[model samples]
Target chain A: MADTVATPKAHGHVEHHDVDYLHDGSLLSWLTTVDHKKLGVMYLWSVLFMFFLGGVFALLVRLELFAPGKQFMDAETYNKVFTLHGAIMVFLFIIPSIPAALGNFVLPIMLGAKDVAFPRLNLASFWIYVVGALIAVTAMVTGGVDTGWTFYTPYSTTTDGSVALMTFAAFVLGFSSILTGVNFIATVHKLRAPGMGWFRMPLFIWGMYSTAIIQVLATPVLAITLLLLIMERTFGVGVFDPKLGGDPVLFQHFFWFYSHPAVYIMILPGMAIISEVVPTMSQKTFFGYKATAFSSVAIAIVSFVVWGHHMFTSGQSQLAGAIFSFLTFLVGIPSAIKVFNWITTMYKGSISLQAPMLYALMFLILFGIGGLTGLFLGAMSVDIHLHDTYFVVAHFHYVMMGSTAIAFLAGLHYWWPKMFGRMYNESAARVSAVLVFIGFNTTFLPQFLLGSRGMPRRYYNYLPEFQFLHQVSTVGSWILGLGFVIMAGYLFASLRKKMDAPANPWHGRSLEWQIPSPPITHNFHEVPVVTTEPYDYYRPFEPSVKGHH
Target chain B: MWLFLATEILMFGGLFVGYGLMQSVYPEAWIAGHHHLDRIMGAINTVFLLCSSFTMVMAVHYASTNNKGKTIMNLLLTLGFAGGFLVIKYFEYAHKFHDGLLPGRFFSYHGGGPAEQAMFFGFYFCMTGLHGIHVLIGMILISWITLRTMKGEFSSAYYTPVDLVGLYWHLVDLIWIYLFPLLYLVN
Candidate 1:
């Protein structure tokens, strides 16, 4: 039996002309392009800049620690380098890397929307972030802050550094973060397309939704915490100053109240991107879709109670420590479920080893190591031993570097065609991914061993015995840096070429694939009505395009 | 809109947590701290903020009905109250400065244990300083609303600006209510 399909007329004419590709010629137009694709690209370029900037600081820190004994700089200079590294990486890079960039670009398109709910506000949030980042960098140039990113009090208040200015910069950045969170929450709640039931929404949206909740609820606390620190530093407020009869531990309480769940904020969106890429490339519907979606929410909720785990050795009550440890362990279960679900999606399906798939595969292995090591830290006794050690540093890098950074690169590669309307060098992209994976492990894996062997973190100089691992980590950093440069060069060069990517470049099933490449302003001509579940691969693959180009 | 208010509450709620914890641990110091505050100024600021909130709501009501004249009138009233709050705060801070009740290592009161007294004055300056910034922001909003009302920009159909301003004014009043007790009524 022959199957017939509705084919377009053979007059060599397509039905629709590509709408105006450039944004409307107004400053406000570029400012308010809530076109998820534009927002995503903005986030991508901004965060990549911050990542390299932060990496530069990390390189300086590693160089100073290469053979110990202050070979590179004095304690004060070393203090600034490591502090800037942590502050820039945490506040500027990791926090906004995946979610704001990739998630902003894809979530609305996947949901089949014209734009986020508040387009103007989205632009305002981005500019606010830029302003906040400038203020932070300005603080570094003007005397530099040395209280570390945590800004633990007493010393923070007493130190003769630029604590007030730096804390206020961070406080302003918190407002930017809060605004983005608010925008995302409102968008997800009010902006899904018709017939796209909540359950049928992609796991990326669910992950973003959960992350938005945390961003809204938890970020304000950090804002207040930073505000208090600024007040304490500038006005000599007695809130966190021990000499003024204030409990320094109170600062710890306020800081970790936000910083603890901030870990989830850093990782949840990356997990969301993985959720999207895994099922599509594997050619299978995500197993336990609802379970995977719910796990994002579960992690967001559970992450709140587990923040006390960071304060376990900071003189918290034994009961509080136990409860936190238990909650931390409980949080692990949802993450494990996600891991299992991703692996199960690849079972007995057409698993394609695309560039994104390579990153996703590595994400599972790396995030697994990151997540399991977290359980070891969640145990009070083990954490007490590894607290503030290189082990802690290695574990977080595994999650932040291995998982979020990898997931970010995967999303970048996956959506490159869609965003720029051009295809990158896939072979070069795969090689960079491999280099990053190997270099990242070589850099951080030894830190875990050194941490287990009692090497402390954040020190300007270390004992000679730990020299071998530090050198290895430093070498690994250079490789990692080189890998990033290659990735950037290739993606940047791709933009100059006139490669036409088809709408469904990967033959993916999401709503974004239904639109034109380099989507028009106001996204879709007519809003798409989603009629099937995401990742529905059971039926025969129906190429939705009307005619082949 | 209410969510923004919730965020404001959490922001101040953090300061209150610090206040509560300090009071619990150092009841004597807190009571002594309250003795340093000018209750008269605190009470006047409270009335000023309450009146501002009332005028802000009135402006919203007028804006909803497209009564541009009354909208401008109420917004001016709100701005007047915000100005009044700032004037009173300036006097209070000036008086404290004259009394030499400064904060930190620079504190210079020759009274017995003036060091402890500086802690009290420190919280006072910080809390009121932050409140003053809020009052300044409120005044700016009120001025914007007045200008907008004069231009006939708002209507019953599109009054999110008016409603958001009302919410912000109410928060300013709410923060003063908490500040009144923490800064003045402890004794």
Candidate 2:
């Protein structure tokens, strides 16, 4: 009778203390915490650390190439430098930057749920990521891999360095990615709050949902491809060795199968963050929300078929090349639609130049350039000229660095208060955003020109004629690096001092905005019953009785 | 579990894609390569895996219904079939190793065009070796499930583990079914 009794406290207040909730004490509480919010913050910090690490590598590469002729390192070291830059940036940083951190943190909260469907599996995914990263860093310290991240055959199989270690590391990392994908899929399917229909979900969730599908479907191919590479190195399996009559080109097919859609994996979450931030800051609903959501799925599917474009110069069939080229062009349409939708959302709206909005606008302009140049690369004739040149490097950076990195910054500024229960310096953040935009263009735009002028990429040194552009690009990288440091310093400083951030600081219309700052362990005190669409700016909630600046 | 099995399919799918492309380019070499593989051993392994699948399904069924004795009995039969499959695979590999039909540059088969022959065996070794690893892992999982079932841990209401293990067993069987025609009965 005592256990079954439901009674108020002696003072007439509800006894909320004995719920056996989170806030339980111990180091293991964090180490073994299945709370999605905790895991999300963990992902955020870890990915940010990796981003800085990868940025350090990028700066090292730029310093070495600043005016060519081995400014700081020899060719062998340059190869290792760029290889490390690519491996860390792609595998460790960009892919997980927004999705693993922001998506994991906010998705369940947005849906008004307590945690992801599979919480222990979420912990496993994070640990697996940590282990994979350790293995990669270990390989880096021991002379490093030289075959580049693509790990094309023959070279990958025959490389004398730590290819086995690197490939196995990537192989292990793929499982981590797959597990995260699995968790997201299961959570999205089973864990929406009452009354949140498919259409009413925020566009960010739709973006993550589409990205999860790609992560689940395409990551397995990379897992298998890396395994084969491991087999080739460890057991002398001749699957990709040309000398043994094995077709090295087949390895390219397998690698690109996962690697191409992998680009979408890197960018879609960033695009999703932009979709969320742009409309909220602009004081308008997202224009064509359904079209934007569908485009995420559309890009995922179409990206898969266009992987063959990577192998156009690798001796694939003419028919295969033409089909892939055509598909590559077609895939750009969804990306274009997303850009147009974001711009339309901002057209004549109360467009504020906040830090998050600054980053979002930058994402649109840079991703537009990145996506359009991708069409040129998708064209057979143009690609033949720019296949392995700095042009390709410039094209991807616009997408990966310019677009994804900018979106990552936008999301960071957008959700910083929610995650940390504090507000950062808005003016400083906005200044960094502008600096990053200018520095990013100055760094990459020259590479595009150099690439068009016949400057091949992946080489340690280049022709003397390209020295001026390389120097300018290297200088811009320092400015970009300085911008990142200033931004990081501002964020870190904000955390040390307590600054009050309200529950709905942005005055945005999303489910996550309804929750407490830094959220209680069980997210919502009561499950919010959704009745309207996510971005209903026209219908504002009652003005706050007690507002704080 | 289905998703893990799907990953395995794609793993083998990569090899199959390679094999298909190579066979199209060099049909004669592929035919000669096929002649070198021991069809009898391949056929025996195929039958062994198929029987293992049947026994695994039976084990799952019994475990689901809480028939502990029947579940253990069926699992032992499945494990036995897996053992037989591995033994056949070992002998087949031993024969190839003894004939100097190794992979890559270590290959020393006296047959003409040793490079092409090496390519054939390269795929053969990678596919079968990877599959063998899967079989080994499946046996461990099956054994764990068998022990758990003996403790009456599964029932109709809580038989997801049994069902997942059964799905895994069927996938291993399906892979062998594809492997038999491609490796042993190649046209």
Candidate 3:
């Protein structure tokens, strides 16, 4: 059966060649495309631009913190700058960075299908994202929200900025997320090619499957939370406002209830990228494949119960705090399982430190630190001292930026060839990776120390004692920005050169590599019948090219 | 459809949990507030929604059986009941408005039993208002399937739209069943 399925002429030889998805469409067509790949490309560019915008805000924040007393911008401007940085990065950039951008392109192809389950819905999600982002930018240009991205009550309700519009933008963005989740869930369930069982599917799909669950389950709560928040502000509903009959801590509970799981929504996709990258780069079958896959789901499940950990110092009862602390630590078990499996996959295996692999390796080190620091904050005693401090900021940045953003970069490089049919300048990419590593540590490592020494987060000014570490962190931002500039330089440079990449540049055994580099308007000539595991590296290289163009 | 429904449940679930927490916080206020909510009107609206759910199920059944006329008729009945539900809800809102039984800062009723009665009205308005929006959306969805049914677009083999809308209508009904007891029958 496997022999019969793998025949190159299984379909027919005289296949009509449609142009690749990128070239098939006009500008108008691109705007209205239902093709998964084209949508993915649009999402990729959109997120990248948002990343650049977010990075600028971050640079401004860091620049303001350079001397601490007064920078070019005053304190109110500093608040708005940091708020925009957090809002843009989380809502516009990181949340969609990997899944909606890269996953949209790859998941359908990986499933050996023409497109996602509902391509039109997929397109709708993208436009919805655009609308939401536009609204957010509108809010930014118009007074700008200073309530931080969390939009906690009392302050959020009282803030004079365009809090309502910003929250509405976030609300709209949640719809896009929900729609994408719905699309992915359907696609994964129904669209897998013949013989592709749940276990045989790629680990990245498992990550996405789990992420979609969280997105579907948790995002609606955010929608309602924000809506109720708007009500609290406008009508004085008092759900979150303490000046009325409301409890402000209840707002914290509501925010984190959705948000704590949201952290998984951000990271699980990153871990998913590593699951693919570590095995392909190491040239080894993934270690503890079942464990690694199940851990993704496990992390997602445990994520819901630990929202209270975020409110340890917010006047939550000791009993609830203790329970939350314990549940939070339980997350470490599944998370640690993944880290161990990734490391062991690389052990005694052929390791290639390509740009993608370098980023994967960085994810391991940074996520480990990030995950471990999270446990410290999870402990009720420690969180009291560290809560709302620079430590918390550094911890999240390490996870959100260091881990998820790095994994996104890894995925971008790993699939750049398949995505664009061009290989970037390797030396430059590797140099940028090293610079990012050095600069990231320099920027965030000192903040952990600064936080422990009683320096709070989101402060416009800092004490003289904190100025030196702050300056060092600011300097680190420059190196990080320079690294990204070089990255942009070479990647765009690769696009100009002709298509030089082979179908399987990394000799990856996945179904995606068995097809064309940039893949046709329709992904596969014939739907692939998977007869083996995705990471069957030990087997001889067999390109199951079903049909030729 | 189930996944989308899951999101809807969770969204309303947030409001439900908030309602319960605030109820426990101000039990006397909640009990006093419930007195203003006429159980008769609430029960009447509940019946309308439940009947609409029945009609919706029947519509789906007829669509799956390829009974186009019956499907359309049942769907129209569902829409009528949904409209009836909204009409009753409108009158309930009007009554509350007459008595100044408003939410939060707008609570102008001088005959309140507790100050937190305003908070009770807040939950009442927020929960019902959100649910009312869902009901309105459900009407639009039912109307859509009904139009499709009129065009003979659905058959025994392809009634997914009708079936999905039925599920949504049922959920909307189910949420109201919970809401009626929680809001109007506090005892």
Q: Candidate 2 — which pairs collide?
A: none
lDDT of each: 0.80, 0.83, 0.90
DockQ, per-model, please? 0.50, 0.57, 0.86
TM-score of each: 0.92, 0.93, 0.97
**Selected candidate, larger lDDT, 1 vs 3:** 3
Instruction: Output the worst ten-in-a-row residue range by lDDT, candidate 1 chain A.
Output: A1-10
lDDT of 3 by residue, A248-354 (tens): 99989988988889899999999999999999988899999999999999998989999998888889899999999999888899998999999999987888887
Backbone clashes in model 3, listed as residue pairs: none
Better by lDDT, candidate 3 or 2: 3
Per lDDT, the best of the predicted structures is 3
Provide the TM-score, chain A, model 2: 0.94
* lDDT for each residue of candidate 1 in A358-437, tens digit (9 for 90 to 100): 99999999999999999889988999999999999999999988998888878888887777777777778887888888
Model 1 global lDDT (CA atoms, 0 to 1): 0.80
Q: What is the C-alpha lDDT profile of model 2 across B133-174, one tens digit per residue?
A: 989998999899888887878888898888898898899889
Per-model root-mean-square deviation over C-alphas: 3.9, 5.7, 3.7
Model 2 error, position A211 (Å): 1.4
lDDT of 2 at B13: 85
Best by TM-score: 3
Instruction: Judging by DockQ against the true structure, name the best candidate.
Output: 3
- Model 1 spans with C-alpha error above 4 angstroms: A1-16, A19-36, A540-549, B66-73, B110-114
